[model samples]
Target: AQSVTQPDIHITVSEGASLELRCNYSYGATPYLFWYVQSPGQGLQLLLKYFSGDTLVQGIKGFEAEFKRSQSSFNLRKPSVHWSDAAEYFCAVGRLGGYNKLIFGAGTRLAVHP
Candidate 1:
């Protein structure tokens, strides 16, 4: 079984400030990790994904995440955040092959202050 945990329920950051979102997962094998963001009343969009190779994966909207196998963590980071970056971010873990169900965390809502 695979599961994800996002400890922070909400985070507020000033505009242009750096931000980091934590995510932890439990899985039997090497898991496929993903980060998705959803704006208010909008569908979720894929931010980034890590299947293999590079530990640090770059994502859209100036987002990046590093996979730490030892810690069982994949944390997302942004050097500088803008007001538009405010959204609900979800961390998910899934299997590699075909159609496997993705287990997602509750989600971390980011609030940007001007």
Candidate 2:
């Protein structure tokens, strides 16, 4: 089965520091990669996604991800993280020609420090 793994269960970053969240997936072919952010009591919000085309894709809230097929990874990055960016981030994978279902990772909790 195709699955996603977020190596970091939790991460801490300074308010103005850059952030990078690692994600790896297992699949036979190139699959869709997505980064979703969930605030304290809110539902998941799509931060960014990589379906095809450009390897590097930009997302909302200054988030971006690079799809490295060889590495089977799609890592999310931000230039400078804000305190409000503290949230749970999930990496998801979707099949190209399947139903609208997604396989999600355990999620990486991000903590922002002053």
| C-alpha local distance difference test of each model | 0.96, 0.93
Judge candidate 2 at residue 70 and give its lDDT: 89
What TM-score, over all chains together, does every model reach? 0.96, 0.95
lDDT of 2 by residue, 25-110 (tens): 99766698899999989999999989889999999999999999989999999999999999999999986565868999999999
lDDT of 2 at 53: 97
Q: Count the backbone clashes (under 3 Å) in each candidate.
A: 0, 0
Give the CA lDDT, 0 to 100, for residue 77 in model 1: 100
Instruction: Give lDDT: candidate 2, residue 43.
Output: 97
Residue pairs in candidate 1 whose N, alpha carbon or C atoms collide under 3 angstroms: none
Residue ranges of candidate 2 with Cα displaced over 4 Å: 96-98
How far residue 9's Cα lies from its native spot in candidate 1, in Å, is 0.2
